[model samples]
Target: MKHPTSYRTSIIGRTAGRLGVLTAACLTALAVAAPAEASTFSYPGHGVAVVHDRATTHADRAHPDQYRDSFAIHELGAVFGLGADNRATAVSAGCSASHPCRSIALSFQIVTMAGSHVRINATNLGRAVNEQCPGCQTLAGAYQFIVSTPAPFSLDAQARNQLAVIHHRLDALQTSNASIDDIKQRADALAAQVKTILDRAAAAAPKDREVNPLGTTGPSVTMHRHFDGPS
Candidate 1:
């Protein structure tokens, strides 16, 4: 019994009314779940070590020094993980009494422990049988290290909202003529609330990284935030 055009208009109005309700719901949800400002973490620098080998003479081979050169990566508190890369280059050639001076073949091992120090060991072939040429058969190598860091600190909508409420309360207190003691007590309570909020955020943040080479836990990265109550 309805006109075709009027029926279409009625249907259109109902559809638009439903769409408007859905849009309002979405906007309210977005506002309530608004995200906090963006944040990022700080990354530590990489570790490195370089070595220059000393020439081993045939006679000196009789009493070879067992100890190798090593270096440590300090300030590891922020480092979470590490990767090591090493390479060696032949520096010189040495001649023995029986053979002509030739480049000596060298092999090395880069050892990293759970801690920061890295040990570099160059293989000692054998005692030289004849008088050896000086400064021959030496190599130079370097160890480059890569480090991983933690994620940055950030707050979610809930934390931001909690902070905002605390801010408003503090602002009201600041403008009030309440007793100094009462103000101090309220301020202290607010500061405690702030600490609790920050502590929860930190607990949920990224933890320390485990470095493969270190074979143990790396240094801990922590954010130190202070909340001072009203004096």
Candidate 2:
């Protein structure tokens, strides 16, 4: 009779060194997946030239004006009677160190104006702008507000929510052991849902009416998106 070969019942070929490396890798992956950073987004372009497409949460005064429109918040310009006008509405008294200033993205109807301050319907709150001209008023007033264009719900928020759902479904499909047909079916459904979401978001996106190109007329909002899954 041949002698039985010896073999350990434990994990085969997984030495202490290998185990340590595996554990370290798993920990690193977990660390990297702490949380998803909010994706930065901006609304449809003005149909002519480039559009303002960024927002800031942190306060910084890199420029001399300190608290000026900077067109950083061009939407705010529309609120101040800039309103799809081909020419920029100039502000005589820009936010300087002496004047003190701040700008914020708004998602509400501008009901009225109190000097440089504007009253919005959303949350019954008002914010101040850097307009020194007392007699100037918005030609488009409520319609000038971006939020008013897509009143009630923000298209950005809706798009983000749909994206989150799509991501979750994709993650599930990745880890699944379903058959080929099942996979294809699920994928098709997801694709349809994605198309619907995009249609809605595009419909909801804001437009500048006629902000650029002086007098040339063009299409309204043009909502566009791209996906670069997993950082």
Candidate 3:
């Protein structure tokens, strides 16, 4: 007769080996599944209107009395999608009221998206404003019609404005004569500060809220459907 202890040990070893193999297979399959690609779609009857105005008064002797006002308007129709992590991605084509038919594409991992409160903040500096000359006063403005599914998705304008200001400051610093290292340090610091503020605000805001369902007779697009249509 076989020893009971030996048989138990053999069975245990086999079970362990099977588990290991299964774990490895799972990991391998995930690796081969490919990074999720952003889906592209065209939105019909959707539009976005953005307007910006800026004014600057020179404080320097050479241009002490110089004042300049810049105005821009952006209009577009675009589509938005949610990533696996529930972030927002957008693609649009339209002209600012001032310009015409300029293409716009925005992709950012959303930190939070729920109810009337939708916060989409990104760490990218590309959208920062650039100050061409020093010692010049500057003012800027921007507007956007965020088209998202399920209608009634709203953003915190205050947060968006603060973020824009941060970017503007960073851009202004870049035009300064400060050393590259110094600029980078300052930029990083500013970025950190903005991030901290955003974090705190997010934490303070209420997480749970009532969400308006799709097809509720509000906006044309009511349902927040999958980025890709039903396969």
What are the models' TM-scores?
0.29, 0.27, 0.29
Error of 2 at 46 (Å): 16
- Candidate 1 local lDDT, 1-231, one digit each (tens): 211110000000000001011133333333333222111111223222212212121212322211121111221222222222222222222344443322211111111122233222222221222234453323222222222223323345786677567655644542444543464466557655755665565456454354344434332222211111112
Candidate 3 lDDT by residue in tens digits, 119-176? 2211111121212333222222111222322322333677657655665564454235
Question: Candidate 2's residue-wise lDDT over 12-82, tens digit each?
Answer: 01000010111334333333333321111111221111112211111122321111111111222222111
Candidate 1 stretches greater than 4 Å from native: 1-150, 208-231
Error of 1 at 47 (Å): 16
Q: Pick the candidate with the highest lDDT.
A: 1
Count of clashing pairs, candidate 3: 7
For model 2, the stretches where C-alpha displacement exceeds 4 angstroms are: 1-155, 211-231
